[model samples]
Target chain A: AQKVTQAQTEISVVEKEDVTLDCVYETRDTTYYLFWYKQPPSGELVFLIRRNSFDEQNEISGRYSWNFQKSTSSFNFTITASQVVDSAVYFCALSGEVVFGAGTILRVKS
Target chain B: DARVTQTPRHKVTEMGQEVTMRCQPILGHNTVFWYRQTMMQGLELLAYFRNRAPLDDSGMPKDRFSAEMPDATLATLKIQPSEPRDSAVYFCASGSGTDQGGYTFGSGTRLTVV
Candidate 1:
């Protein structure tokens, strides 16, 4: 069984502010995958990042970064200097059944 | 990049009407999935298939919802006697069986039941 939890239901921040969306997951399988997806107003889900259990390395892409910590069973996403265009519903998911979190609606006001 | 394709981007139908949604998975992908998204329930897996065989459909309502993969590329989800509660964005996704990476999702079909 796998479950994902996103504590933040919605978040609002001014433009150029850094925001972090928290994600926690529970899975019994030693080999599993974690993912983050962004659904914009256009109604399309955009893949953000995928991290496997073996790789605990934190990844940074442009203004976006992900922290995967097996110790805490947490995978967090951070957006540095977020812009208005970054507003969207972000979901955290666990693989091998692909259980998704409730998602956090982010609003980046300019 | 190859992507999954879903037909009937938007559909509005009267209550009790039968609604059918279609999907075309990326070529060479062996796994396909169907999901429904709504404000109350973020994303729920309705059904999934692997090698054109139904893997799991326990998430779907067995009475009125039916899913099938008639061929390698095509997948269909039908809801008979659709109700207002069934209105949601249905998404189709595909993944390479060998890849551990996440699946690629389509634009989704937004269905509205009046």
Candidate 2:
């Protein structure tokens, strides 16, 4: 069985604050993929990033960054200097019939 | 641009009524996925199709829920005798079914069974 866990149900932060959303997953397959998606109030899911299990290299794209650590089975997302537009529900998922986490609701305030 | 399309955007129906949701995957995409999202469940995969064939639907309720891909371009999910507990936002996503073929999601159909 594959499972993804997002421990934080909700987080409220002020603009310019750096926030980290924790994600942990379990899977038996050595070759698998992990993903992060953002769903705003508009109800559309926006793809953020996709990381293969073999690559543990931390990635940075603009103000959004991801830290994938195989040791902890964790793939955490961090937003540096988050803006109000970043407020959304973020989901972490494991691929191969894609299993999703419970998601973390992020509220960025001005 | 290429994107998955779904309808109706929102549906409110009485309990025991049959509800059907539709999806049109991106052209040339080989895989289609149906998901249900709610406050409690987050997002759950109900079923999926590959090359217009049903792959896995273990997540769906066999008795009340049915999913089908009548053609390569179209997919449908039907819930017979829906109950209030069945209310949720149903999403349709399409992919190439490969590691790099990240899924592209539709806006989703918000269903309210009262």
Candidate 3:
């Protein structure tokens, strides 16, 4: 069985500050998928980014970016100048069969 | 935009009562998943189905919990004789069976077993 580990239980940063959430996963499959999801207070899980195992390239979308390193078994997410809206619980998932991390709670203060 | 739809966004029921939550997967999506979320447990996959056929449900509590997809679009999760421990948000997600990248999640049903 695959497992996802997010060591960070909570993160707090003032608005306009950058934040990074670390995620590590263990899986036997060489080819799988990784994902980041955001869940706001509204109770909806929003998709943030997805990276395939074969794709090692770091991806950037606006103020959000993800680094996928197969060697360290890590897929980290970074938010640049995060806003209050960015405050939420972020989940990192490994999708050979869709295993999710314990999730990191982020609070962006104004 | 295509999105997974879940009904009864909020449900408050007494313990020992039956609770049923419904999910409508996005059109053309062949895979559906049920998940339960709580502060302690975080997120757990309860059941997974493809093309209206159950593939795995080991995460579900066999005695009081049941999941089924009677058709391609509809999926239901029922908990019989619910306990206060069952109070949590239940989410349903769907994605293309061929796509392993991501799954679209519904707004989830918040169940409060009092």
Q: What's the distance in Å from true for residue A50, model 3?
A: 1.0
RMSD of each: 1.0, 1.0, 0.9
User: Looking at model 1 chain B, which ten-residue stretch has the lowest summed lDDT?
Assistant: B94-103
TM-score of chain A of 3: 0.98
List ranges where model 1 is wrong by over 4 Å. none
Candidate 2: RMSD to truth: 1.0
Best by DockQ: 3
Q: Worst ten-residue run, lDDT, model 2 chain A?
A: A91-100
Clashes of each: 0, 0, 0
Q: Rate the local accuracy (lDDT) of all candidates.
A: 0.94, 0.94, 0.94
Tell the DockQ for candidate 3: 0.82
Docking band of candidate 3: high
Docking class of 2: medium
> lDDT at A103 for candidate 3?
94
Candidate 2 at A40: error in angstroms? 0.6
Share of the reference A-B contacts seen in candidate 2: 0.63
Indicate the TM-score of model 2: 0.97
Residue-by-residue lDDT tens digits, candidate 2, A1-110 = 99999999999999999999999999999999999999998989998999999989999999999999999999999999999999999999898888899999999999
**Model 3: per-residue Cα lDDT over A1-110, one tens digit each:** 79999999999999999999999999999888999999998879999988989999999999999999999999999999999999999999988558899999999999
- Predicted candidate 3 versus true structure: per-residue lDDT over B16-60, tens digit per residue: 999999999999998899999998999999999988899999999
